[model samples]
Target: MIMDNWISIKIAAQGPFDLKRTFESGHSSFPIPLKDKQDRWYLVMRPTSINTVIITRVAQQGSNLVAEISCPQRELKENEVQSMKKILRTTFGLQLNLAAFIEEFKKDPIAPAFELYRGIRLTRAHNLFQSLICSILTQRNSIWRWNAQARTMAKLLGEKYPVGHFLIYSFPEAKTIVNHSELLTKASLGYREEYVLETAKTLANKEKKLEKLKKVPTNEAQNALLELKGVGTKVADMFLLYGLGKMDAPPVDIWIQRAVSHLFFKKKEQTLAVCRDKLNEHYGKWAGLAQLYIYCWARDHLK
Candidate 1:
């Protein structure tokens, strides 16, 4: 009977929450193993120290959102439910205010591009560790390949639970990866195995440093992340933007490079340096969100 009870927590959508728009923004396009059926989207998190898999079903009900939180291994405790609520809020951008950014979008030079995909916000990982692992997996690989690698790693390293006929794996923690370093090989990480291992070890050893890094300025955070393995400029920017919630960081991938060149520079001859400076100047604090909208719009329109 305890398992039968689905703890429904209501999230205020007065900030104009758009579930579909959030996923469509391309932020959720990563291979994070988000399972959806009909209107209910399933998300799994391992928030507890004992590797408990918390399964949450989020759905839009009218203007607000309801999250049904559960745990297959055990009944969801109050603190566990509260932690799920916090993680869900972070993942869904529930606490973020987009009104100011939306207003600024009106005067943006790429206003049409941003308007085409409005209500889009950055969908972050459950934590900075997850974001760093995802960034390492994504480097120099096709979207398909990186997604596959991520799913494989999760299946091998993460805790999973059965829901009806389906089994979903939660995102693995740094300790999980640290213990099963051999599993990274099983996940087909190839040359990225060392980077993944080193990253996990670094996180495991440097909790205090990571905490200090989080409170620093964006430029300092970027520099700190760059010191990690397999973290180049783009990966550092990705970690800052999506992981640390620095909206000013515009991650310049190849597609974004081409998109910014065409839109702001008027041609493909613009360098990445020029493109980043010009766009940051134009959008200011909204640079990262603007990048997401412009990238999504350009992929749809420019192609």
Candidate 2:
């Protein structure tokens, strides 16, 4: 019989962490995270290594974050619990030490952003496949539209689990997506449907390719991701940063391009390649975090 109890785990941040800023940052491409009246954040995800869906409730307890995880379909095992901890750590960037980056960029044009969005971390998606799909969905679309599409896809394709009085869905697996390709049309993906299907097929057959991206160098990983359908330079870089945790890969989208041009190029238009190169040259390994701060700052101040 399935257990009704929740397993609680506490995770310590390496330096400073802000649970509210990180969860509401709007930096990630995953479906919007849910927060209840009690200030608890809820995430429904299926870790790649685990066989079941996990519902996690995260709330800040002093300096540390406490996660109450539940597997409604079955009893949570020891190995799965360990894997959940690792996944939560990765997803929330609990182990990242950002003191150096903050100290280095304290005087730069993006410095004000650091103060405004303090404790905002680079949040990752559930897994590589989900990241890839979310990247594809963001192409030529606004954040709200793409997020809605992703949520719709999850509702249509993902496994439904009961959490309290609510039912949540896990992001569908590649094999599940491959089997349900027709449902992509219903998700309002438009032209992205074909790309999502092809990518899902590739992942379903050779998922190790996606897993291996975590071990490879940044440029090589970007190249491999670029080979997939609907993946361009921006999409590849997005996957690199958010999917595989490559901090040096900063994606240059329209918003980032505008921000970079304004701050570094004196509002003069520059090519995407040049903008990306400038970010790499300036921030080096901290380019991804820089991009997030600048992007958020630009969205507010630039417009």
Candidate 3:
């Protein structure tokens, strides 16, 4: 069922929401939002079950958000619309209830960070395969470099759709990636090329196994992700937190380790395991979100 024009949908945020802060929170794994001349933010993506490129113009309206979504290449079905709504909700953390976490940590040392990045939310990847590849790319890599590589990969291999005067791309599927594995080298993936291709082959062969992690316990999912090539503790934690929505998995990168050391360990160097345990003890289920905030704050203030 193709519509003649773009369809509009309204989604209500469960709590305080800031579109700008959430979309541009410096999470390299998440797709970057493009701003038009009118300053409207638009994100282009594809539903997991369909190849049609969906374009959404997101705007904040009071306590609710408006997503003016359209399938530029075809008509969107009702079920696809529903799936898009769910994806948007998860991507923006629209259903996250942070009231208790905010109130409890309002006076803590990281409290200033909470205020500084008040409306920011944990932004997840569009899919597990994308997240896994991104985690591999980020290993021993600068943020700018990895992000560029991701965008280049998408541009070269992803499906492109023309919306209005602009052209946008949806991240390529696993099979497409597997078939076009050689193109990845052009993206400058370097040593990560083998890991990414092998991961894509696994996803193409056993996608159900990867998707099943979303419903499993955090520790169990982390263990399974660790079995994949190029996945270490940090990469496994990243995939669990950002890909599987396991909020208890705190990704202890260098920035987060430094933040935890200074704030909780009195400037003493702490092991990554120690930082993870401290974050879990202090923040509990919200440890992943806390890690995101601390990472952003440290990147800005610590340097």
Candidate 4:
């Protein structure tokens, strides 16, 4: 916990926890507007599960990015903290090492300059119901379609927050969505609706017991997440990686499958076993970090 003059902290070139992306993925809260806000990503950190909820603008200052941390639980110790600085120096870039990783990217600096972020975070689900539902929407569809389903569902269930023109909303909970489950199904979820309801119901039944999942090992956590319908390996990995905060967890969606094929496997005929081995060998437990960087890069660069 570091405390310093707010202005000086803001301009410190780099800091950890300034990660522009949301720890949780389902929410529209982390606004990565296409063109308007180019220099920084507007994001809300630690929104639901954690008390560290704050809307902050994330931008790189010098070598490390900086953020205006706003969690109520944080007591910025009078002792100026350097923990933030350390995280950035270690996590940024794709080659995996901080400064070393940056040098690897220097070979093609343009892409790394704007999109990639560093650091490994252990996040509480942020919003379990939201992620569970979004995972359902994501099943068997392209990311584009998945986002559309989630957006529509959010508008249906979320309570709009008025922040000028930025109309963001919090994702609805299982208890709340239960009342409107019919509308959820009717909106093209079709067969997947059962899985969505089953997931929500399971969470609803468990209540706070789901917190115990965090203590369970990653394998157990992933297995439990999959027991509920609609939760396959990728969705389970989503909960483990984003919700339970497992680092090495990587959800091998079709996009990742294709990307791995192009970069590592070099053949459409490669076996899934080879893909898993290569991914595991390269990234180990931090596979999610590697996945995200490649996923982000592939989204923009891949043919």
Candidate 5:
């Protein structure tokens, strides 16, 4: 049932909004690549059930970004609209005023590179469990490998819906994984299979845990996530930073270590702990944000 009327919500942003940069930051496969014919970005997501909603940034009128939101199952209900609004706002970082972060970056040594990618923010996972799984799958693996595994996981466990002639799949929920732990092996998860299953079961056991994590202090939340199987320091920090909306959490991988070393430590040798401390000291609350932008930039631009 296609409703003739689509609700138009205006989002005025504090900093410059660049949909292209945000999508290209190597987040995942949800946001479809640019299409000249559409002249906008399309995001397909499923927050509940197997049913999916397709959100598009339809237009930019002055300082506001107008969103055209629609779901295949039905017209969005009042509560659904609020949910979509919150998810979209968070996904696009509209609530994050980056003026101060950008100002601080301008004074840094890599200011030019950071400025070149100013509007790019961390495109977060759909949920906390999904973020944990992503971090686990990405550990010590190439981006290509993790993306392939993610796509396979999506197709196998996610609910499928028809969008025109095409079928769209959502990211698998923890319940789905908990119900079918063996299916993960087909994705060649290897040693991480057990960890993924355990994490899924843990998340599925309590619906309130993810919600509780949002309210917990950053250090406690990090430790709690660390308790889950396959979750290490980097994975926990990534979950805290991207999943629980804690910008103070900086997940420093080798790339970030190199970037930090070169940009801040005068290319001196430093431990990951020392590097993370430096990033926190310099970027403060925006440390995670700075880490993401610089990580992406360094991955592509730096040696």
Candidate 6:
């Protein structure tokens, strides 16, 4: 019943744990937070070396360990190791083909557009419920205010773990937040509190297939999300890109509309569908990554 030869060693990734956080974030599989002796946040790591799950943890001193969930059925052979290497490399941006692509773009540079926020990485690792809540909290609000709202919600509903000189907030489960509607006003979620509750209550029980979601048809996934109480195209795409790893998922926020509006179409009033088509044409398979990088860039610079 345990995993195969793949051991999920999450800590080995790096300090800016983008891929690890995405996998552990429940938007994919109910990413529950874990901790080590030093109270640092850890996630479940599934490595291919050994066929078992590891509740990977990082201590204050930065030591990493993989606590075996169960023993593997068999050791991963060399062929399997190579296969896993390929899968991991592709699935996660492990070895960013920075050399090849950076050379191509070197002539033009990353454009003045993407430079202001070169190093800002998204690090929020929460279950889809929390992701949905934060995304909903984000819509139509300033990113700063939305971040404030997120922090307020975390402080109000989530648990705080002290790690070295810093502290990280663990987002509460869907059931916890849904059961306490009054916390919204306290958390300053504003008008989206109802949306947050509705979405959470809807998925809190239904078994959602989120991990390895790239296999699912985009239309089906988008429709499924649309069926959720507060979820719409934007929310669905956010889940697809951030949680489910669909590189084709183009998440459209108002800021992005402005960024591409004049540049792509020579008009500032471009429609969402038009923008989607343009992005699909330009980014192709990795359109989701494009949207993410551009979204992060646009949000910071446009503001």
Kindly list the per-residue Cα lDDT of model 4 for residues 39-144, writing each as its tens digit.
Answer: 6443333333333333334465544555443223355443323433332222222123434333444453233622444442223344555655666666676656
Candidate 3: pairs in clash: 2-75
What overall lDDT goes with each candidate model?
0.72, 0.83, 0.78, 0.52, 0.70, 0.53
Q: Which residue runs of candidate 1 sit more than 4 Å off their true CA positions?
A: 1-3, 14-16, 28-32, 47-53, 72-83, 205-211
Give lDDT: candidate 2, residue 194.
90
Candidate 5 runs further than 4 Å off: 1-6, 27-65
Task: Please give, for residues 46-81, the per-residue lDDT of candidate 6 as tens digits.
Answer: 443343333323322232222222223446455654
Model 6: how far residue 117 lies from native, Å: 3.9
In angstroms, give how far residue 240 of model 2 lies from its true place: 0.6
Q: Give the TM-score of candidate 6.
A: 0.64
Candidate 4 matches the true fold with a TM-score of: 0.65
Relative to the unseen true structure, what is the C-alpha lDDT of residue 62 in candidate 6, on a scale of 0 to 100?
A: 30
lDDT of 3 by residue, 16-119 (tens): 67777776676635556666675556666654556566777778787667778887667788988888888878777776876667787788888888778877
Ranking by lDDT: 2, 3, 1, 5, 6, 4
Which runs of model 3 end up more than 4 angstroms from their true locations?
Answer: 1-4, 49-53, 72-74
Q: What is the TM-score of each candidate against the true structure?
A: 0.85, 0.93, 0.91, 0.65, 0.86, 0.64
lDDT of 1 by residue, 1-303 (tens): 133557898877434567777765545424534655656777676543324666777788765678887776677678767777777776777666666667656776667754576566667666457667777777787666777888888789887666645767666778778888877888888888899899888887454455455588988898888888888888888777777677777888777788888876776657766777766888887787777777787778776
What is the lDDT for 92 in model 2? 84
Ten contiguous residues minimizing lDDT sum, candidate 6: 62-71
Q: Model 6: runs farther than 4 Å from truth?
A: 1-110, 113-116, 119-126, 165-167, 212-214, 296-303
Error of 1 at 130 (Å): 1.3
lDDT, candidate 2, residue 272?
95
Query: Residues 1-303, candidate 5, lDDT per residue (tens digit)?
Result: 332455766677777676666666765323333333445544446564223555344444554567777666666777777777777677667788776667766777657765678666565655555667877887787776776777678778976654333455667788889898778889897788888888888878664477688798888988888888788888788777777678888888898998888888888868888888888998888888888777886897767
| Best-fitting candidate, scored by lDDT | 2
